[model samples]
Target: MSITLTQLRAFLAVVHSGSVTAAADELIVTQSSVSAAVSGLARELGTPLLERDGRGVRPTPAGAAFAPFATDVIGLLEQGRRAAVESAENASRTLRIAAVTTSAESFVPRLMQAFATAHPGVGLTLDVGNRDRVMGLVLAHQADVAFAGRPPRDARLEARALHPNEHVLITAPDDELAARAEVAPHELAARTWLLREPGSGTRSVNEDFLAATGLAPRTLTVGSNGAIRQAARARLGVSFVSRDAVADDLATGLLAAIAVTSAPAPRAWHVLCSGVGPVRPVVATFLDFITARGG
Candidate 1:
């Protein structure tokens, strides 16, 4: 007889639990049934997978090596079962998403909540990172979809504009720099400016703004939005961030926007996908939800 997935699962349970009784309890079968399954599996593979040592069970060297493979097989099989059930209930269920840090915080969570409400059976995974890391997730097929300020120029990806992102300079409410409605890029050139890391999309936009005004500050790189926001709150300097990210701070008077005359207009936020193929249904659903909400 062919080895069944059930037999593989039983063997894995026994190996993981390290006792036939425990494995039986986990599998909801009798200890004898679990032992029979393990023995059958061992015979099918033509190897001794386990042995009794004193009053406990231990895996043989071959079983120890095979245990991981069995675990993986059972895991994939269980995932398949779950997917099949979900498909029967709602064929659109799936997982795989990537987003730049700012959007991940400001927009992605709401989008996910909406999607979850619409498709309760769906499995979801959201990858959050900087611009380059998010793009890398998409290209590597680690994520089926991604959200970012702008798509990379790489020919192997497809990007569609989802919304407009306005950049603003933010400072603590009590900060000396908060009084001005606007500050020239050169005015703070000598100051210590908090910024996202070099490869961040925000940093890139900030660089363009500085370049346009022929000013570059002494930048202190902090890799995350939260870190940069805290730095700005501590009056470490000032930072240019997405208007959406600082909305709460703006509303509560914790931070103030610095108007810059030559600041660029709002840029487009794009949803990026690998050019490798058509978008998955879950990814499409998320994109549709975000775009519909004006992102």
Candidate 2:
């Protein structure tokens, strides 16, 4: 017996939705079915695909490496079907978008929806990951457009400013420094700092801030932005993150921003695309819409 589409779907569902129960709900199947499919696939592959994480679930390193390939396989099959149907109609078109984690959680959805609403004939699919994965998609010509804080300097990619974005150092609402006028770099040296995994733009920003200030604190690498947020909420450590990603939490006093010297310089969110060749019509159309309407 070999791996099946059923197993792939079940695995991806749990990866995306973060739990077997959630995956079952998303796939409209019983939790046992989702669990069995994932376990069976892992057994067939001779590896564990998931690990329990503090009452939830997380992809094992092997599973994390496998996810993008699995996503592409499903996406390509869907794309082929759409291409066949759209060729007959001669009216429908598909657009693929990729965005880094922060933008994907924030304004990118609204931008996508506005474009989709304005152009009802276009089919939109989005892939969200860290900066490295998103840029990989753009450089490989797998995605029509991408959004990120910045791309590594690459001659083949063109990036235009979408808007100014800011990162803030956040802690639980009752942190000791929240009442201070300002914090010094040395004051933070004794505290623990939360870092995103490598290849993440947030980690890049955190590194830049630390470098500029010459402060090295105890650092713990949490894998994702959501985990960092939860860590901050639990007072596990301080984290640097997009304001947009935690605006509501800040406003509601669930998280507090602490002011510090020479930290968190403002950066711009950019719309990115390949500069090496002609962009597809659907790609051009989306760029025009956002350029005119403001993403």
Candidate 3:
């Protein structure tokens, strides 16, 4: 038998939720129906996709490989359905956005408010996460468009430079480094740095800047922008963060910008969308709106 959308959905739910019972709850179907769907899908593919776990289930190797395909298929089908519905009902447009944390906390609100004022009927959904998570949403087709501090490298993604993103070195107002007019690059290697997670765009940029300047400082990893800011405020360590992210703190003396002689040059914030396919009307309209406003 040919594979069916329902079967794929059921299989994906099970894989994501980790159990037939949980998948049934998510799909709003009975456990037996979910079980039957998984069985049917496995039989159609001539391989077992799942194996039992302790009191739950896990994907077999074949299932793990198929997960991306399953997510992509579901995403595409949902997009098509939304496109059709929105084409017939112009007032019911929906746009989805994924944004990096810095943008999400700073500029995204103003952008969203302006867009809503211009197109009041369009329903908007925004997902705010770190850079890696936002990129993953775009790759998974879960977001119609994304805003990020750095351009993506994947062939499936297309990006436009929106605006300049300036990263600045920050320290507690009382810290010794804050009073310097311009800290030399050689002096930077001795400072304790509060760093974000390894895969973060901010961290990557900081690393690249350090590599170019031959400065390697001791780092204490913090997961979130808020945490990093707090750490810097408490004099736990100094940090590099988006100017937009620390604007209020800088203004109020909660944090002070440390002028460094060899600081990183401004990088462009990017507007990214899938390059491999046609964008939906809502997505197109939002892209045009943002680009016109210089993002």
Candidate 4:
């Protein structure tokens, strides 16, 4: 009998997730079923693929060598299946998206909700990460579309402007900076600042503002836009973020937008995809829907 896609998936899931229980949970199968599939696959290959590691499992040397092949086979099959489904019944295709944290928190979910309402038969998946991770998803073909606050620097990506992403210097409502109609760059030079991790799009913009103003304030790095918002609201430090991310907080008087000299130029929301090929129909549909929404 030929090796089945199910067997490959079971093996790869275990290898990637580092445990059979986690793989079973992800696959929605019982641990015994996952073990059986891996065992069956090993029998078909006439070699051992995995072995017990303490209470869990680890891929054998042979399994490590075979892992990439299994992944590629599964990826190719998924691509072929998506192509067939799109050609036969376009409404059933899945649209996969990856977006940076700011876009994800501020607009991407609502956009996906609206898209789902308009295209009820289409399956959708949205993954959120930092700018680098989102760009990596697009480059790896793991996501059909990518959204960010800035255009991707990768030549392999084709980017389209979506909407203006207005960034503001935000502080707690009670902070001294909050009382200013406009805070000058020099005024910001010595304050403590809260910002996103180094590779995030927001941090890139924040760094540009810092460079333009020649300010190197003491800074703390947080992993998500939500965290930064919370930190700013707590008066931990000021942060620069897309206005969309803090609109509710701004309106509620929880956070104040501080005007700053030599602020980063207004950046636009961007949609990106692989530059070299035609996208799936569902992806095209999502792209059209988002572009029509004015970001």
lDDT of 3 by residue, 77-110 (tens): 7888888888784449888999998899889889
TM for every model, in the order presented, reads 0.67, 0.70, 0.81, 0.73
lDDT string, candidate 1, 205-231, tens digits: 877877878876788889898888888
Q: How do the residues 217-261 of candidate 4 rate in per-residue lDDT, one tens digit apiece?
A: 999998888888888888888878999889999999988888886
CA-lDDT, candidates in order: 0.79, 0.86, 0.87, 0.84
lDDT of 2 by residue, 1-295 (tens): 6988899999999998899999999999999999999999899889999999987899999999887667656655654564566667576788889999889999999998888889988889999999999998876567878999966798778887877799989998999898788988778887789998889999999898888888888899998878888899899989789998999899999999889888777988889987755556677788888877656
Q: Which has the greatest TM-score?
A: 3
> Candidate 3: TM-score?
0.81
Model 3: per-residue Cα lDDT at residue 81: 84
lDDT-best of 1 and 3: 3
Supply the global lDDT for candidate 2: 0.86
Please identify model 2 stretches exceeding 4 Å from their true place: 1-91
Residue 134 miss distance in model 1 (angstroms):
0.4
Candidate 3 lowest-lDDT run of ten: 82-91
